[model samples]
Target: MALFGKALLIWLMILLLAIANGILRESVLLIVVVKTAAFIVSGLLLCLCIFIMTYLALPWFGRLPASHYWRIGALWLVLTLAFEFVLGAVIQGHSWAQLSEPYTFKDGNLWTLVLCVTFTSPYLAARLRFKQGSKFL
Candidate 1:
C-alpha cells in the first residue's frame, strides 16, 4: 500500500513536471485532466485485451500459473508497446530504420519505468485501503 501511494505520488510529480515544462514552453501540454481521461479510456480497452490474451496464451508460454494479474499486465504493456510502434509506422508510412534520427532509448526506458511505478503504487495503496476500511455507503 505504501508503495502504491508512492507510485501515485511519483506519477503526479511527473505530471507536475510536465506542467512546469508546458509553462516554460508556453505551448499546449497534456495536462492532468487530459492524461486522466486518456488513461481511463485507453486503460480499460488495454486491460480487456490483455486479460483475454493472458489466459489464451498461458499454456503456450510454458507456465501453469500465468493467470497472475501482474504478469498479464506486464505482457500487456509489452504487447501494447510493440503494437503502437507498428501501428504508428504503418499509418504514417515511415519505419524506424528509415526515419531515424538521434534518439535516446534510455530516456524512453526511464519514463516507462516511472509510469509503471506510479500507476501500480497508487493502485496498490487503494486496494490495501479498501481491504482495511468499512463501507462508506
Candidate 2:
C-alpha cells in the first residue's frame, strides 16, 4: 500500500540516522565520555532524532486516522528489529547473545528504551501535530 511505502521510506531515513549516531558515538562521544555515558547519550540522541523525523514526515502520510499513525509506528518497530537482528547476527556474523547484549540494559545501553520510542513516535508525533493544528493533517 502507498501508506506502507511512505512509512518504509521514512524508516530508511531513520536507519541512516541511526548509523550516523553509532558513528558519532564511536568516534566522538566515546572520546569525550565513559562508555556507559556514551551509550546513554547516543541512545537518547537517536530517540530524539527519531521523534523529530517522524514529526516532520507526518505530513507525507496525508490526513489519516490516529490508528494509521499507530500502525506506522508498529511497522517501523518491526522493521527496526528485523534490521538489527538480521544485519548484526546474519550478515555481521555476531552471535545471538552478542547481538542481544544491548537489550539486556547492562552497561547503560538504552536500546530497549530506544525501541520503545521507535514504536511510539509516530502516534505521538501525530498527536503533537494535531494539537498544533498542522495544516498538513
Candidate 3:
C-alpha cells in the first residue's frame, strides 16, 4: 500500500481501538466508581496502545516521501479532530459547545493530551531509526 493508504488504515485501526477503549473505560468506571482514576488509567492504556501500534505498523507503510512524517501527522490530526466532532455531535447528541469543551484544557479535560499524542506518534515513528534488537521505548 501507499503511504497515505497505510496511514489511513492505521488511523482507522486507532479509531476502532479508541471506541472499544471508551466502552471498556465506561464499564470499568461503573464498577470501580472513581472517575479521576479511571480516566487516567484509560488514557494511559489508550496511549500505550497507540505507541505499540505505531511502532509495529509504521515500517509496514514502506517508503514514503521525504516530508511524509509531517504530512501524515497533519492529516491525521485534522481527520481525528473532525471525527471527534462529528461523532460527538451526531452520535452522542452533544452540542457544538459541549463538544468544544474537550479541546479547551481549562475545563479539566485531558482530551487535548490524547490529541497531542495521536498527532505526534506518526511523526515520532517516522523520525526514529529503529535498530536490531532495540526496545520500543
Candidate 4:
C-alpha cells in the first residue's frame, strides 16, 4: 500500500508539473526571467514526468530481458508523438494535419527525439539509483 501511495503521489505530481507547461504558457511571471531559465525549467519538468511514469511502469515490465528497455523507450516516444502532435489536435477539433503538412518529417516534429531522450534518461537514472542503493533526494 505504501508503494501504491508513493506511485500515485509521484504520478499526480508529474502530471501537474507537465500540465503546467500548457497552463502557465509564457506569462509575465516567466517572460521577465532570463531566456535560459524557461528552457531549464522545461527540461526539468520533462525529466521529472518521464522519471515518475517510467519508474511506476518498471515493475510491469517484469521478466523482459534487459536488452529491451530501449524498445520501451522507443515505443513511448512514438506514442508521445502520436498522441501529443498527431491525434491530439484532431481530438481537440484542430486541423493538425494541415499544419504539419508544411514540415517534411512524417515521423514527427522537431521535439520527438528531444522528448524521447527525456523519457529514456530517467529510466536509466532510476536504474542507476537502484544499483547505487540511493533514494530520491
The C-alpha TM-scores of every prediction are 0.32, 0.96, 0.82, 0.52
lDDT of 2 by residue, 25-92 (tens): 99999999999999999999999999999999988898889899889899999999999999998899
Clashes of each: 3, 0, 0, 0
lDDT of each: 0.38, 0.93, 0.74, 0.53
- Highest lDDT, which number? 2
Better-scoring candidate (lDDT), 1 or 4: 4
Q: Please write out the lDDT profile of model 3 over residues 24-128, one tens digit for every residue.
A: 888875468577667777777788777678767866866455477668777778988989888889889998789887677542346778887787877676556
RMSD (Cα, Å) for all candidates, in order, is 13.6, 1.1, 3.2, 6.6
Error of model 4, residue 137, in angstroms: 20
Q: Candidate 4, residues 50-137: lDDT per residue as tens digits?
A: 6766665555444334445555555555555665565456666668666554244343222433475645753584575568664441
Instruction: Give the Å shift of residue 131 in candidate 2.
Output: 0.8
Is 2 or 4 the stronger prediction by lDDT? 2
Residue pair clashes in candidate 3: none
TM-score comparison, 3 vs 4, better candidate: 3
Q: Name the weakest run of 10 consecutive residues (lDDT summed) in model 3.
A: 128-137
lDDT of 2: 0.93
Q: What would you estimate as the lDDT of candidate 4?
A: 0.53
